[model samples]
Target: MNNQQFQTPIEYLKGVGLSRADVLKKELQIYNFEDLLKHFPYKYIDRTRFYKVREIQPDMPYVQVLARLTQKEIIGEKRTKRLIAQAHDDTGTIELVWFQGIKWVEKMLVPGKVYVLFGKPGFFNNKAQMAHPEMELYIPGAQQKGNLTLQPAYNSTEKLKQFTLDSKGLQKLIAGLLEQTAKDIHENLPDYIRNRYKLAGRQESYRNIHFPNDANQLNEARYRLKFEELFFLQLKLLRNKLLRTQKFKGNIFESVGDYFNEFYHHKLPFALTNSQKRVLKEIRLDTQRGVQMNRLLQGDVGSGKTVVALMSMLIAIDNGFQTCIMAPTEILANQHYQTIKSLVGEGFIEVALLTGSVPNKARKVIHQKLEDGTLNILIGTHALIEDKVQYKNLGLVVIDEQHRFGVEQRAKLWRKNIIPPHILVMTATPIPRTLAMTMYGDLDISVIDELPAGRKPIQTVHFYEAQRLRMFGFMKDEIAKGRQIYVVYPLIKESEKLDLKNLMDGTEIMSREFPLPKYRISIVHGKLKPAEKEFEMQRFVKGETQIMVATTVIEVGVNIPNASVMIVENAERFGLSQLHQLRGRVGRGAEQSFCILMSNEKLSHDGRIRLNTMVKTNNGFEIAEIDMQLRGPGNIEGTQQSGVLDLKVADLTTDQEILQQARNLVIEIFEKDPQLAAPENQILNLAFQAKNAGLSWDKIS
Candidate 1:
């Protein structure tokens, strides 16, 4: 349709009045005619066959029957009143009942007339009955005369249904609008794209999606729509990437100077893995390029991401520029500071930690050092972005657990320097390929697929309640060997009270079993004060405690090389990603580590899949793929925070091939015509501009 016509208000549609339009907007977010057209049906039903009255079974799910209305009456009084009608055919009769809107039904029902009834069948007082059946006057030969064999089913709410704007009502309104606007519907994709992919025309797809002639047409319509949705999303992300690369310039690190070399050669703790080396080369290449680098570094937990980040930072220092690392939590910031400080050794390079807990006296010193360009590296939590904090010639920014920080917060760091620093976002959580492409598509991705040498893969096992004693014995043996253990309970927000009770009860049981001075246990949870939590964590870190019992609050930061065991209680309550992260708490030391998943005997289908998947593999990427399939894309750890996966038709879990194809096509288009200056791409330029008209990340400048 023409642009103005497409943007016409929904209230002006054929069947939608002011009241109905309000309901439509509130119920489904339909504001304009284009939105009404794009609201495709989620389900389709075949209406070719009709069941006989006597053949109706109580267990049947929604059946259609052609029968004659014989008699009707009202039952009960006041609020309990309901309309009951009997419909009979050649075989027998069935009862149709409606609890509400009795007046509307009574006026519509005509005795001794044939009607088509559709609803779920159930037994009431040992007789078959249908409640809230959809009724239509029977018309012979209508099916052969262009009536849709496949009927669409739209989603509706009770509030909408009260206004006669239910699924059927929506269908009628859409059909009326399509009859007038079908021919005016515009083709969004260019001719070459439609021909190469054998995609249906936009008009045909929209028509078939709402009312299909048959199953094949319906499938074709769905495929075209899904591909289109994914293609445009990929196009937007890739275009943003292209524009940013062309527009922004970065401070170049021309040499791998003495700082990097010293740390890489003499002060190295262990040999760098081949994967780490390869990723470092990528970062080296990116920093040397003139364009600003926005890259995502994905590595499984304990995969030596920190070393790579530190080396990259050293490159910045070598180029005479300051660097900073922003972490999501104070605990993680402290961990990074201690690790980097020890690795840097004494008096080689100046490093400082700036977190909220840092006192004003020490903070003043850090600020002064940063401004005077004496501090080579600074690491902190969100406090690094404070207005009081300023840096001289900041060239590289390393964000740890980047998803935990909002886009605006990360943008604040860019304002620190006239030239935005090269960004290196590191995450221990492995993201599925499709997700990474959609959510972080604007950023180049580098994956460290292999673990560092000498670190053993954590052996995982599942234990039932009956086997608790055996598991405890195993824990006792590990503790006796001078290794620490973590006992984590599920602390979901909805069940915090019950989970806390479980934690306290489990702790009491452990005290009773191990008992007295021979065993020591430290407890940490979200409810504890920061001082209390830090004190308990330090006891375990220092080996003063044999066990640390807590909730998933320790999922990210706490790192204890001496801890060799992770026992997750009620593991079935946790998602696959969380379970994997909890499992990563161990396997850091030279000794082999074990993760024991404890759940009850009875397990749900999804819960069984989660636990079994954990037992079968320790590959974080594999676990992440399965997690996406099980929980869908939006629910993954950082996806919601990205705000990019607002998908209506594309399912990332099942549509990987489509997503990849779309990304490849977008790259090809950029290669051929970066600005869409080609005459054949005029339609694409218009469509892209129309779809993306607001201020996005790429538009920040």
Candidate 2:
């Protein structure tokens, strides 16, 4: 036994030489001995019992038997080939075809060898056929029905197969590794913990996942491992949270009296919603606290998040300090500016906007004002954090659409002050709890659940494009009633190809569809330069264009309350959350708003779910939940997104209890041994370090 780490994978183990090892590594990401033990099956075929051919039908997805390969042949070109074969039992003979596997069948076939065959029986050419069924060579008296029980189907890759690392090659290598290392499995969990949870030792858990003799064993293995993964994940989050809270000191500004009076007395164009008022109180309390305030302000679209943010900024300014708001896009930054400039009045506050496009001189002035404390509040995109734009007495940091920026970028804002600024982050994206825990566990959360008075909920409808004429007619009628319309399209062109067709196609179709010049129409998409896109978006926002036909690029977010209708040309292409966010653009005003999802007739189940979800409700949280459920567990871990969860085995959808159990356990552990240094928790600290180093499976379960 060796203590060295083998992160390479299963196929590259000592006994697994270049030939067979090549296959496993390529077909699977197995380059070390341990990977084989953990390479669980994607699915299982219960071959413990065999079925009679007479018992099989078109409806039966599973069938088993002893059969002989009577014949095998290949057809089609090299790129598109098919393997035709025949299998027979006493009841009857059936065709077994494997598309694109002709060569394997040809090499492995023998004239009269009885073997085990398993696959679905289906009708092709009005006869029975089993395409690309799993096959194993017959052994004398091999259970008679051979492979009659649960069978494992390991996932593989083409690169491994290229090295002749077929399924059998993988099975053999795994067997070799198991024989060598199976007995060496160590129990890292304490006895008391295992007994409390009724879990098996670590060794049994690993083996059961690989070669479980029965379903019960597999269940036990899954539970223990998943628990370990989730528990560690939650534990890591708690540790990070404790470290942050204990070490960081917030810029506490108490008695928000001056700020509140200045805004509430003579300013504040509209009365704040109760929810907004509540959130502001929370923010005020948070900023008054000693530790740095890492709070998330969650609200639905037009839920007064910005106003609440502004009031908090007022608190910082009233305390004779400055704050900065960072948005992901220029349009959103400018939109915030427009709202503040419109509502906050001119002289009471000195506000400036900084973006990448600001002129050199203008930027220099803004930077100087910021450094000298002349600037009270600044709103802009990433330009707010550029090396030159230093802050004076920076007390609060407000990040809008916080998800758009990375943790590193946000941290930079916090670090601008001697003590990290009291952080108040805002998001229009109503993320679900499962996702929130994984992403926002490091911060305190405050949600603004109420909408302002006169705010209207968007009326959503799902329909196929075949009903386009009727939908357009309805839009026309709405437009005729002194309202505007947005017809959004999907982008089919890359940045390289000039999508004249996208602009021309949408413009022409929309113009002709709605009686052209009778209704003013404009087009917008990503292909347009920032200036041009802004021009078209401005036109639509101002109601200068009665109908706007554009691509999903308009999803770049131009908030238009006057536009009462949103018609996504091919809604099926959008995720449920995206569709919901698009819908959020409208329904911000007092007027009734409508979202017409005009998707193509051919919609995938997920696509239909997306549209149906939109039709079901305007709740962004509900839509985000649906999206997470549909996307499954492993997928949400993209470059910036997936890292948020950082879970390995425990699934957010299925293992929520385990997540809670981990959280509760950590709380208990911390209560007793805050430093994780007690004898019972000593090994745990080491194990936690090992696990965290191996996989960042902590912080997000």
- Top-lDDT candidate index: 1
Runs in model 2 lying further than 4 Å from the true structure: 1-3, 8-11, 15-38, 59-62, 66-116, 119-149, 166-168, 183-185, 492-503, 514-517, 633-642, 693-701
Worst 10 residues of 1 by lDDT: 492-501
The local lDDT score (0 to 100) that residue 174 gets in candidate 1 is 90
lDDT per residue as tens, model 1, 1-701: 34678789999998888998999999899999988888878787666578887888887777888889999999999999999999899998788999999999999999999888887888888777999998888788764432336878898899899988888888888999899788888888999998999999989988989999889898888888888999999888888888888878988899988989898889998999999999999999999998899999999999999999999999999999999999999889998999899899899999999998999999999999999999999999999999999998899999999889988899999889999899999999999999999988888999998988899989999999999999989999998899999999875233645433267788888899887799999999899988899999999999999988899889998889999999999999899999999999899989999999999998999999999999999999999999999999999998886778888778999999989988999899999999998999999998888787675754322
| lDDT tens digits by residue: candidate 2, 596-633 | 98767777788888888889887777877777899864
Cα misplacement distance, residue 453 of candidate 1 (Å): 1.3
RMSD of 1: 3.1
Off by over 4 Å in 1: 1-33, 52-59, 68-113, 123-129, 143-148, 162-164, 172-184, 492-501, 696-701
Worst lDDT 10-window in candidate 2? 692-701
- Count of clashing pairs, candidate 2: 19
